[model samples]
Target: MAIEKKTIRLLILEDSQNEAERLVSLFRNAGQATRVHRLTGIDDLNEALQHSWDLLICAPSSEALDPTEAIAAIRRQAKDIPAIQLLANNDSDDITAALSLGAQDALPQGEDERLVLVAKRELANLEERRGRRASEVALREAEKRCQLLLESSVDAITYVHDGMHIYANRAYLELFAYEDADELEGMPMIDLIGASDQASFKDFLKNYQGHDGHAELQCNGVKANGHSFAAQMSFSPATYDGEPCTQVVIRAHSGNAELEEKLREISSQDLVTGLFNRNHFLGLMDAAAERAVNAGQPATLAYIRADHYASLLAEVGLAGIDILLTDLANLLRSHFPGEAQLARFGDDVFTVLLPGLSPEDCREQLGSLLKKVESNLFDVNGRTVQSTLSIGVAGLNEKTAKAQEVVNRAHRCADELSEGNGLKLFDPADELAAAANRGSIVAMIQQALENNSFHLMFQPIISLRGDNFEHYEALLRLHNPQGEEITPLELFTAAKGAGLAEKIDRWVILNSIKLLADHRSKGHETRLFVHLSSASLQDQTLLPWLSVALKAARLPSDSLVFQFSEPDAIAYLKQAKAITQGLNELHCKTALTQFGCALNPFNTLKHLHLDFIKIDSSFSQDLGNPENQEALKTLLTSLHSQAKLTIVPFVESASVLATLWQAGVNYIQGYYLQGPSQSMDYDFASGED
Candidate 1:
């Protein structure tokens, strides 16, 4: 396949028939026996270059065989052909100057030493051109072969020139809907494409002639049935009928008709769920992001993993998963309107893009939407099964600027949030936030071990009658060197978002137990309560870790209350229930801190045996908002029969306290009791308890 430099040939064009004949004889006169082709015109010269002529030696001619025209023609047919035009007798300097114009040889058209040397030198240049052209041709042929092997090609292939179709492949006729190869002849190549795509196709063609721009590209091509599929094509300007033209190759991905489609995507689709294969869906998400950027929009990526999909999948394998995906996909399509791109990412994770929507708006909607999805049981293989979901949403925000950056964040958040299907929305702002730098936050927690930035303050849980404090809830704070103490509100929430919840929660628990014991040792008895993040349950070591922390503080299990929110409780309901039940066995108490969430099942109360349920602020706000008061009273009374329920009315004013007394909430815990008092100085907010 590799042609040697010695085997190179040259096309010679000359106006002087005798001189051209003599030039051919001189080339043959070479002791090396090199090949020299004698042509009279540009057409004949160009035609000879296609089959490996290394050089084009042109001489003055009368008609189409003129050497000047021959050089241009050779350049067009094969731009890499080394060409040298010949001139007449060397008349002092005029003859040599004439040779300088186009000829590589001079000397009165006689075969001599100078002519032989010139011929040999030009042939060497021709070899270099041949190597360059061969490389380009090989690359084109390889790409064409790849096109032929594509199971899902969209390009049509044709070998023709001068508005005539010399040959058309099956894909070529079928893609353009031409009845036969002859049908495509005498027609412009643009006619196969739609009016809109024609101009773009032509522009692509024009660019291809000058540059290597004809790679993979998509356009629309008309079909015989008057329908069309997006055609992805590539072109290479090559030879046909010894003339200048481009050989185009194209493929049609799928047809417009659903039944006649190339890929049976529905089979690959998980019916009950509507996610694609693990491999397929991730690729789809990446592709969707690419499309989103092209369309000038901020792409939102979400990974939804069902907590109990494995049990469902195991119970009913392929058949069941299919029904699940199909149903889920249909539901998603219905909920999201106007061409929302959906990719069934994996078994439990179905990715989607709501492009152009702000992260805040999307977060609120996904928060509500996922709740609806988790509120019911899905029917699978004649068995009704329930599963909660942990959905993580990530989007192109200020910090998460790129598509992959946002996607990786979203996936990582999903992993953090997947508390047996519990949803986690990861914020890039959590770590590198405006209030705290990442280095300092981590360093502060580490340094807290020695300097005691970790300290607990108790907010008195006053009784309804205001007779005495029922107990004190342990709250945490961090004191920076500036003397401004940061409350748990500042760092705790942010830490939980950054996967530091386990360490912080454990630290708080140990410190709280120690503080409670110390207070009791000073003859001040107070029950200790520590808050836990949803992330903590996923930590396999949390229970054993808690047991050790409890023993070290010499605190009775019953004196410790583990506080958790209703949404968090419901999200990892199975795990939450198990932990709560275990705590009960150890005689420890558990309270739902923010109970009665908008979407949580009050029915969950009947299922979970609890020590206490703190009605959410929404239901206890303004205690006598009548609707709220009555709702709280009914919920409390219902719980009173089942368990000891504490209706903690968060009041900040006298009116709220009076309303709570009338509403009959059992306990009050809020700023109205006393602000989170500083340990160094009890310069709390101006309030009377």
Candidate 2:
């Protein structure tokens, strides 16, 4: 619904400009907004046919243009426009000839009312043909994507029609101990399950209609070798090879102690710095708050933030930042003794809980630690990078009943402090003001949504290799009442807090698809990478809604790549996997953005099949360092080995280009290429090697 009404692009084959204007005016009189392009000769007609048009109107009696030749030319190009021929006189022979030449309808010239009616009819017919073609293309693409996903997925997957295996992926064939897909071509669905659960599965399948489909069961799976293993099988309704079928996904269940330990570590520890994650840190803060209220114990929480963190990231990259944080965490661990907790509280910010410490003592300890951090030159890939930290202290007392309140206060004070000050104590007034400011932002987002005031910006994703296609990442921008653009971070935070993230995502998807479709109609092979929020990933209706949107826009499924952050995909692994699978089934591509930072990044990839892996921007910061460059090369090699394309972002310098190119990266993007712009005008061909 983003594009409430469609504008018809009409191509007119007429020697006289005045005649073309007159025809266009008739459509306008009928309440249509027509964009008309008049062709004076065959050369112009041939060039114009490359662009998309809703309808083609030709004056048959023009001296320079022959109606039969024009219709034949349009047909030869295979352009799906409803061609209407205008005859100066109603000669039955001429009319029949025009129809034979592929004209949809022939009308007499100067019959204004009849011409308008015929034009509207032809335009409606054009829309219908386009819609039908789009749906057919989408269905075919969906089947292709499904095949690719199944082949690449680590889990065993197969499609069953009438309880017989019609298709199986490599993983399924290998899992069943079969050498190839042909070995399991006609296997019954019940043969893979244990005898005990066979009857129950049959009963379940008898009532399955895809509407009540998604179900998982634990059962013993029998391999081709007759060995049985405990497996978890999930069933979902799917269509494969243009036939109705059920898709079965199986994963071996293991009770390995090491895997459990790794899972626990991932849940509690930050993958980069090996410190407590944000959730675990908040839990510690809550316990500290309870102790302060119940036992009357004094505690202080210090929020440490890297000053100008964005600039530092651009300078050193994620690997460099990781090294800096690891060294800083070591210093904090040594400086603070037992009963003190340290956490990497998300994105260049660290938190420390000091129990049994007075407010003045907490400030004194934190100030000394800050000085130590500032004075030390951290070794980031053999390059000494000097950085400063800003600290904010908030004391827990009997009056502080909630831990989040204390955390918010500390963050507010940290934001208020200047870089020169480097430290600040939490002020109650600042907390109140911050709350009021957040409330205002939430209201602004709601108003903007109501007014349909959000817009999209694009940044080019340049290919390191010679890829002729133009690719861009679509970014959302919102305008406030003052008509100034609000940053995406602020806008998303407000939308999430207000429980409107899903709505915002839907808006972005619809508008981006419409815009991409229109752009492609202009003869550009453009692809858009649209980011989705966690809410959209978890929404059950998103896939079906996306199908309708794509069909209406007539855009190819592969043209729009849906992306989400690595952390979101990991945190909501089940939902993310389901969404990704569904997207694959719909023939759309998927990308995991801000990747390579998780403790076990590849572990998530093993469960969900993806087409593109966007290396976290952190990796781009220190590519100048040979050590960092080697690390990046190794990561890209691993990903390439898995048949996954790699995209590295934040390429700000020419020096880094050689490193990324030599690393065998598939795509690279940064301000050096171009920043986000309102238009998709990046000269991809000019940058081609």
Best by TM-score: 2
Error of 1 at 276 (Å): 56
How does candidate 2 score on lDDT? Answer: 0.82
| Model 1: residue 409 alpha-carbon error in angstroms | 28
Q: Write the per-residue lDDT of candidate 1 for residues 578-633, one digit (tens) a residue.
A: 78877787778888777754233475665566776777666656554677778877
Candidate-wise lDDT, in order: 0.63, 0.82
Q: How do the residues 347-413 of candidate 2 rate in per-residue lDDT, one tens digit apiece?
A: 9889989899866777777788878888988898988988888888899988888999888888877
- lDDT score at residue 628, model 2, on the 0-100 scale: 83
Each candidate's clash count: 39, 4
List candidate 1 stretches off by more than 4 Å. Answer: 1-452, 465-470, 479-490, 678-689
